[model samples]
Target: MVIGILKMDICLPHLHSLKDKRKVLKSLMAKLRQKFNISVAETGGQNKWQRSSISVVLTCNDSGFAHQVLEGVVREVENTIEGFLVKYEIEII
Candidate 1:
């Protein structure tokens, strides 16, 4: 099996407080889950209001397919978010 993992550092510029951040993250996460089959979560950056670290993970039987899925998912996430993105990294194991 091939495992794909994606880590994204995101910035929510419109958020003024932790509550706003939670709203944005929860909404985005719901949309992501509706569109993809992977598991998603806020894995880091808990204390920062504007910054969030998200992780997505999934497993597939083929490496090429897994890579493609990860790429597509990452792209979708980047395009869907209203805020700026700091960085993103993907790994296949």
Candidate 2:
């Protein structure tokens, strides 16, 4: 099996408090999980209101497929997220 992992750093310029951050993160996480059928979580920058890091993980029988899925996920995030995606990294194992 091939495991694909994607880590994304995001900047929420409109958020003014942690509550707003949680709301945005929760909605984003739920949408990502439901749409991609992948595991998603807040992996870093939890205490900051304007910045956050999320990790997406998926497993597939083929490495090429795994890479494609990760790429698709990245595209989806870039298009749908309410904030700016600062950077991202993908790994396959």
Candidate 3:
């Protein structure tokens, strides 16, 4: 099995508090989970109001497919999310 992981750092410039952060993050997480069938969560920057780190994991039979899926997910996040991307990394194991 091929395991793909994606880590994203994002900035919510318009957010005012943790509550707003949760709202935005929860919506993005739900969209990604529903659309990609991947496991995702907030992995870092939990106490910060404007910054967040999120992780997504997937299992596939081939490495190329795994990479492709995560790449697509990144684009989806960049396009659909209310916040802006700070940085991202991808790994296959």
Candidate lDDT (C-alpha), each: 0.88, 0.92, 0.95
Please list the residue runs of candidate 2 whose C-alpha ends up more than 4 Å from where it truly belongs after superposition. Answer: none
lDDT of 1 at 60: 91
Using Cα atoms with residue i matched to residue i, what is each candidate's TM-score against the true structure? Answer: 0.93, 0.95, 0.97
Across 1-93, the per-residue lDDT of candidate 3 in tens digits comes to 999999999998899999999999999999999999999999999999999999999998999999999999999999987779999999999
Model 1 whole-model lDDT (C-alpha atoms): 0.88
User: What TM-score does candidate 1 reach?
Assistant: 0.93
Return model 2's CA RMSD, one decimal.
Answer: 0.8
Roughly what TM-score does model 2 have, to 2 decimal places?
0.95
The backbone clash count of each candidate, in order, is 0, 0, 0
Q: List the residue pairs that clash in candidate 3.
A: none
Candidate 1: segments with Cα more than 4 A from true spot: none
Q: After superposition, how far is residue 39 of candidate 1 from its true place, in Å?
A: 0.4
**Candidate 3 Cα misplacement greater than 4 A, ranges:** none
